[model samples]
Target: MALSPEDKEEYDEQRFAWIGADTVLATKDSDQIDKHLRIIQARVRTKSATAHRAFAISGRAGLGKSTTALTLGKKHERQRRKLLGDGPEVTPVVYAVVPPGATPKMLMRAFATWLDMQVPQRLDAPSITDQVVRVLAQQKTTLVILDEVHNLRTTRSAGAEAASQLKVFTERVDAAFVYCGIDLLTSDLFTGDIGKQVRARTKMYALEPYALGSARDREEWLELVLGMEDLLPLANHPEGSLEDEAAYLYHRTGGSIGSLRGLLGDAAIEAILTGKERVDRALMDDIILDEEAVRHAQESTAPSPTHSRAKKTG
Candidate 1:
């Protein structure tokens, strides 16, 4: 059924609109996500007479670490619920972000809040810790994830204290613990006496960023870009439309998954709004040009000696 010119134009517009607001694609990071899920699932399934062992996953920002953690956590939680089959809301997987400058008391309060339990105002750290354990047990939470754990206070005595509190939490709860943060290997949470104990019990996984200099990385990155191009809404789609711009995209995004998505997302929105059938290098270049201008403006206004000296001489 060949369409008339008007019908083809309308269809292209509709396709553009559909791609404009598409959900985030995580196919590029599936391997990392799968590995993390496997570790969590194994621990969650294991029978434990006492406290379960903990695990740590570390990755830099914009690497989809949190997204991977939350996505897998929710998926397993759903599976656990399905297995129970209306017996109860067995929260087999729980995810929470660690509060900035988190103390033992603050951590407990956050945990309690996540579990829908009341935060006691007058309770000390130990008391709150007990309450959190009880609530987690009652909810049948089998895997607990504490993200951004690097933000927890971990200096001098505070570091040891926080570690001690964490040890206590893991010991008291039967659920396995998973900590997500950046640079965990170098973090204070993995040093000192208590840190040594944590290091001994936990398995560590580090997510590496895509490096443009590596042949394998370039190949993987190109695959990701092409995958995104496939999802772009367009009429009269040309094969390898975005292949040529692969290097440019990598340079612009520093080979980060999050940055690539941002570039593609903006391009898709512009394509829809302008009623264009496809995205091209020119559109993405304009976006990057505008961003560079904004960054330059910010730098120009910053307190630098050259600028300050010029103003004074003027």
Candidate 2:
């Protein structure tokens, strides 16, 4: 059955949004997310006065650390509400991004804004911290997930200040924190006095890129590709094509799930805009740097090492 023009246009728009920066898709990394969720829930469930320990999700740009943390926050929010049942709406998890080059004051303001509360003008960092803490308590927040935590590494003093603020939060609030960013454990944010305190308390979890070195890794990578295939709104199915292009896709993306998604997403967009019906090798050729083309170019152009060696011998 043919889709009406209106329906087709809407479907295409929805497909585009599927791969947008804000949209979170569950990948193989979701298993790790499940573990984090369980940890946070345990922290919430435990009644002991034992000091709370935080955890981090660390990875390079494109490993979906931010998405995973944000998604976990949302999931926690829903679970919190459901558990409350007849109780008033309580936000269990608060998600915030550490602004680039943000100071303690700026970080407080960001937190205030994320909570939908106004930051009073001309307030000191201590006052802002108090207000933010009160609000989180009022909202019954159990966890705080800070994304782009590496931004705290702007400088030694800045990193220390940020780490101190976080440490204070852990000391003052009942909430456990989750920090997500790149190489945060090795950053200045984990170095120095206050940083050392935070590093001592928070467990580190690393999210590595998908590897194609083993059969298990390859299967996981292919599962990711198939998951993305289910998102594309192409008239002709593109499921098998991704499996067929597995080697090339892995090579182009270096097994980074984000890069793989971007390559396939951009190709899907091109296919939609050009009315191509579906993604194919030829379509991907135009969108991604074709590996075959690169191989042919390299094979054709360079002076032969064998010939050079023969000439040298002669």
Candidate 3:
């Protein structure tokens, strides 16, 4: 049986494995990160209640850009919660991974649930916006993290309507959002109305493929890439160290942290299931070349790729 969309997402989170993409993103993509952080710092420091702070974060696929934003959101809120309190004064950090072909109502529904607010039964575009804005005002959220933003584009209106919705949502609210997407020209090459709006509010970060770097940086990055515990099974291999695998792993994932985690995790399990306890370089190679790995993965559990989008149930 095909998994529900919600079930597919849950399964993906549980099975994820590699670290190549995240390592480079956290360590190598310094310039991009600096800019993203700067924007966040600016927003949080705004003194005026009426002044709004908003910006966009765009990176190439396979970079840890989204993860980085999510991390920032998570950490910032944690610190804020400690400094403030657990009550309504705390700035709620909300996250949403926008879906491909998603309408504005769909996006709004996601934000509503993210904030633990009521999801309206009829999620029309206007209602979605009204309800979400009301909830954000009620919860006092200061930061919103939108991951996989490239997926937010839909076949309808070529994303014009959706873009307008986001623009309206971002403009009137005091809250800030860190929007994550693929590299600027390659993935988003933002066109027409949507392009202009994204360009206006976003601080673009172009995350490129990973390259070999300093020894300490590479080691730390690799450990972060594949968690120490995650790499324990590979210790018995004669031909490998986790650090050695990092470079090749980076190439396979094209520097996308999310994909890197999923790819590596998938390879490790495949090796163990095939009677090989050690995840040597070769097994990683098989997974590296296997484009099918990703497809097979989504196929195993996710809903059949839905070209026909479903409207959210009330």
TM-score of each: 0.69, 0.81, 0.68
- Lowest summed-lDDT stretch of 10 residues in model 1? 305-314
**Worst window of 10 by summed lDDT in candidate 3:** 16-25
lDDT of each: 0.70, 0.74, 0.60
Instruction: Candidate 3: list runs displaced more than 4 Å.
Output: 1-27, 30-35, 44-53, 86-91, 152-158, 185-189, 213-240, 247-259, 271-278, 286-314
lDDT of 3: 0.60
lDDT of 1 at 260: 71
Error of 3 at 310 (Å): 47
What's the TM for model 1?
0.69
What are the runs in model 1 whose C-alpha is more than 4 Å off? Answer: 1-51, 86-88, 156-159, 212-219, 226-244, 266-279, 288-314
Which residue pairs show collisions in model 2?
Answer: none
lDDT of 3 at 282: 71
- Cα lDDT tens digits, model 2, 1-314, are 38899998888788788656464567677777678658865875677666678888887777778767777777767777888653544767787888887788888887888888887789977899999999988888888888888888635677567667766766787887888888887776776665677777778888887777899988988887787777777787645677877766766666666666677788888987888768877777676533543443344445686666322110
Q: Residue 51 of model 2: what lDDT?
A: 62
lDDT of 3 by residue, 144-197 (tens): 787777765533574557667877887666577777777554444255555765
